[model samples]
Target: MAERLADWKQSLDVALFATRMNFRSHLVHPGEVVLANLGALVQAVSGAAVFMLALSTTGVVHGWTLAQWAVLTGFTTVARALWNTVFFGTLDIPDMVRSGELDHYLVRPANPLMLILFSKVDTDVWVEIVIGLGMMGVALQASGAEVGAAVLLFIPVALVGSALVFAAMHLAVTSLSFWLRYDAMLSMLVWRFDSFAQLPMSFYPKWVVAVFSTVVPFAFVGYYPCLYILGKTDSPFVWAFPLAGPLLLIPAVLLWRRGIARYSSTGS
Candidate 1:
């Protein structure tokens, strides 16, 4: 047990060191970083504007008031931003596999997936984090939602779980590259499906809800967690959403291991 704990700590240190190196490398090109952040700022503003415009026209969506919808949207944005900031490297797996770049990761002492998935940081995504937090503040004020100790504690838990869910889905999809030789289409498809998660699951038809909650499990990432925060759900099952992150990770890790076992370098 001590040996395993020590190994885990070493892996964590390696991941953190790599992340720091990635940031320092980006700092060498400060101008490009600023420009990229500016572009991200525009996108964030546009997204928030779209939600505002929709609420202005309709005043309500499904049974949710504008404020409630804002909370949902805010939660979605924050979850997505966190995922992209931390695990954006997972999206590069297909390209790396296709180009034989993954060969470099295979020989490392640390876990290959850990090295590959956490080696890079998207510094520009800090803009999204800032904008997301601002939106959440506004939504919280507008909705006048009661905050209990449980809700406070669960906020970080939900965010971490939501990001992990996305990471798991991305890893599962990208691992297909090992056999299929191309996973870009499937990756894009999964990402497109996530757009549905921006809204409350209550608005969806029964079948859609079942599909997302079970087959995809995207609802646990943002929808169900937000419902719990909004005091709209009291089901004991909802408490399981945070654990869904590690549970979902199991299949992803298994598939990744299988992929690695089957891997053959392109001999570049």
Candidate 2:
């Protein structure tokens, strides 16, 4: 227990250091942070505007009301903010592999994957985070849903789980860099799968829903969380999706380990 506690503390310290270093690096240019937040706010607004405008005209999207869609958008924007700021570093695996920069991480005392994933931070994503939560709160109020224990407990837990699921997914896909000489396009393609979660999964056919739920599992990121909050379905199964993140991480970590075993530095 002592050893595990110590390890957790060390990891936490490393994470903090990484975040500070990343901030310092970016802050070296005084206007960079401001520009980042401005750009991110515009991006967030554009996405919400597109959906809200359409919903105003149509009243609903494939059975999802405007307010319900806002909940999903909140979940997606926050999760995407997380993915962009943190897990997105997994996409760097290809560049690290090709340049043999991965070797530096491997030789470090810390876990290589943890080091890589936590090595940078995008501070600007706070804009998206704020917008996402604002949308959720305002929409929930308009929809007459109470922001009680469930909302306080569930949304955050769901977001953490959602982030983990995609982190593992990206790690697994980018691990392909160990075999392929160039994996940029493939990684980008997999990363784009988040767009599917920007709206309700009900809009798609059953097979597409099945694929996202299991094969790729991006559905857990937005659809299920919002479903529960919106009271759209009575199915108890919605509660189980958060567990899927850690479960899916099993195979993803296995693939990553295998890729590490097979890797040979370019110098080889």
Candidate 3:
């Protein structure tokens, strides 16, 4: 048993080492990193600017102050970072599957899924972290909701939950590549679904809210937990939302594994 545990630990270390090496290789291509960073910066800045403009026009919408609203925006931006970092293969899965690239991935010494997912780190995504946190700080000031150390305690939990939701959503989307040969429309569909996550779930109809909150649960990563942080929802559900994102991932992953089994390699 001890040998088995050691083997597992060694495998984990090798995975981590390989990931570090992949990141280092990208760093050598400074131009690509610069271009990617620029794009991410533009995305983060545009998002924050638009949210700030909306908040200014409304002053306070649905009892949420600008700071509170900004916190929601930050949460969504963080979700973007999580999505790109952990589940980006969703966008690339179809291409890999159709090109017989998946065969190579399957034969790799490391876990093929982990290697494919985390091998390419998006360096520019840090821009979102900077912009989002800056907006969150401004929102905190505007809302006069000085978060205590206790609030910081919830941050790690929220981050983990957000990651789980990202993985679940992206993996589910990518799993369709197993059977769907033409996936050119998949990216557009993902973007459309993600657009709903960018805004407060409260502004939508109750049924829409129910769809996201209970069915898909994207709300747990950004909207619902932020509502609690902003003191908007006093419901017990908000307090339990952080766990929802992670719990939902179990079924999603199982489905993804099943899909993998069904994957028929495209000889091309």
Clash totals for all candidate models: 0, 0, 1
Q: lDDT value for candidate 1?
A: 0.84
Which of the two candidates, 2 or 3, achieves a greater lDDT against the reference?
Answer: 2
Local accuracy of candidate 2 as per-residue lDDT tens digits, 1-268: 9987887677767766876897789889969789878988998899889878878988866887888788888887887787777776788999999998989888866667777778877778899889998998888888766667866787788887787778778888898888887787888898777778876888999999999888788888888887777777657776677787778788888888898898888894
Q: What are the runs in model 1 whose C-alpha is more than 4 Å off?
A: none
Task: Give the per-residue Cα lDDT of candidate 1 at 77.
Answer: 75
List the RMSD of every prediction in angstroms: 1.6, 2.1, 2.4
Report the number of the highest-lDDT candidate.
1
- Sorting all predicted structures by lDDT, with the top scorer first, yields 1, 2, 3
Please list all clashing residue pairs in model 1, or write none if there are none.
Answer: none
TM-score of candidate 1 to 2 decimals: 0.94
Give a tens-digit lDDT track for model 3, residues 1-268. Answer: 9977776565566667767998899889899999988998987788678767867878767666677777887777776776777566556777788788888767666556666666666677788777877777677667876577756777667767876786777676676777676764774576568767767876788998898877666777788767666666568665467787777778877876887788768765
In the range 51-161, model 1's lDDT, one tens digit per residue, is 788778787678787878777777777788888877788888889889989988877677788887689888777887788778877887788788788888888889889
